[model samples]
Target: MREIYNELKRHSGKLTEFAQVLVDRGLYTNTKHCVAMMRHSTQFRQDVQDIYAEWKPGKLKTKDTATHNAKLAEVFRSIKKKELKEKVETMCEILEETLMTVTLAIKHSDVRKLGEVKANIENILYGEKQ
Candidate 1:
């Protein structure tokens, strides 16, 4: 019973930590930022779980079993690589929009108009970008 309780506590603690990550990252006014953060946190937790599973002893092992470990490691690496690639793509879109807005404001907006335009763009991008 004590072992079961300990295991429950361990899992609950991990979930609590992941929830905290969501709360902290939720501060971003942008939805994409929130989405990216949550996805990253989830991926990190999954990676940890995969490593833990791999490290635990199996009921049996043969020469083939060693190859299984290597394959699992490759799979984990691939998952992380894919996630990183997605994040880069999202970041590029955000930066491109910001740059385009700034350029348009410079070209067409006057001093007073620029302030209003900037504020509007901020509200649109970062939900009142402080």
Candidate 2:
């Protein structure tokens, strides 16, 4: 802000005094220019992305975990179309841990062996619906 003020002082034929609105407009214009420059900077973009990642790490992880597990849940549906209608218990916890393991395994598997990994997991944990 002071930099903008000094520059404005020197720019208009080295004026010693300026109107209040001119100073205000100079500050506003400088702010907008700085914002535009930041918007165009790759480092600024990365900094913003880092801030968002820092802001909600847990929420983002939970959402990602849900999405990843949904893929595993589709495998579950291969054996049964039924949804748990009861107040499920520790078994649900076990099932979730097991599913999460498989989900992570599938995520880390080699691209070439993806189909094999998925097929093997489904064969072991579930079978055809009919």
Candidate 3:
């Protein structure tokens, strides 16, 4: 579980960097750009789901009681880190929000509406004041 969590943290960091690049490239509107962003976001979401599927909580049992207790303690400690959990949750939220914005932009054919959505996404991704 710790390993999976660490992997998720790393992936989230990568996603942040990727999102910055997309913002830099001005690819925040239009169907093509939205599709590209959605592809990356979808891939990350699926990867997380796959990791979650493989994670089994409280499954680490051992013949040695002392070792089993120690392992359990370690797992609990790792999972109890509030900051790490919050960061993961925030990252997932950002990705989902971006995907939703892109889907909306794709559905609306009005250029002005797409531009507004793009501006909103920029603010969301970059913390820019709107």
Candidate 4:
């Protein structure tokens, strides 16, 4: 149970960082114009905010995985811009891979492998060669 909670907490942190990348990339905005013109306008900002809120460090010690997954799916579905949507979807893939890597590391008790996975995740997220 502790291992599972740790893994979930790590993934949540990654998701928050990814969300910031989206904001930095202009994929998330407080601008009403962008929100209004975008599809699923009503849920856009709030969805992003909810993700950030729920995933903040020290906040996921006891969260329901199913609920978290559902919220993430909704946020992805709310993205209407083709390019931004693709980027977000790609980020989602990265997050899934990171989660799997963490789980595997915990299962095998492989600390070195966990470090490698973390580095891989960073490279993927930042578009850096490693």
Best by lDDT: 4
Report how far residue 32 has shifted in candidate 1, in Å.
62
- lDDT, model 4, position 17: 46
Model 3: per-residue lDDT, tens digit, 1-130?
2343343345435334433444555545444453345454533455434534554343333269888899999988888897678866876786677677667767875455556666656766676784
lDDT of 2 at 97: 62
Across 1-130, the per-residue lDDT of candidate 2 in tens digits comes to: 3333343444553222222333444432454454444334344344333433453333222236877899989989764544443324444654566566667767887355555556645644664345
Winning candidate number (TM-score): 1
**Candidate 1 ranges beyond 4 A from true positions:** 1-63, 110-130
Q: List model 1 lDDT by residue over 7-76, tens digit each.
A: 3235535433433444455444554554344444423455434433453344123358778899999999
RMSD of each: 23.5, 21.1, 30.6, 27.6
lDDT of 3 at 95: 65
- Counting clashing residue pairs in each candidate, in order, gives 0, 0, 0, 0
Q: Please give the TM-score that candidate 3 achieves against the real structure.
A: 0.27
Tens-digit lDDT track for model 4 on 1-130? 2222234346545434444544665766643433333333333355545544555556446778999999998877776567777978888887788889888889998887778787768866787774
Q: What TM-score, computed on C-alpha atoms, does each candidate reach?
A: 0.38, 0.18, 0.27, 0.34
Candidate order by TM-score, decreasing, is: 1, 4, 3, 2
Cα lDDT of candidate 2 equals: 0.46
Regions of model 3 farther than 4 Å from truth: 1-80, 110-130
For model 3 the local lDDT of residue 123 reads 66
Note the Cα lDDT for every prediction shown.
Answer: 0.53, 0.46, 0.55, 0.60
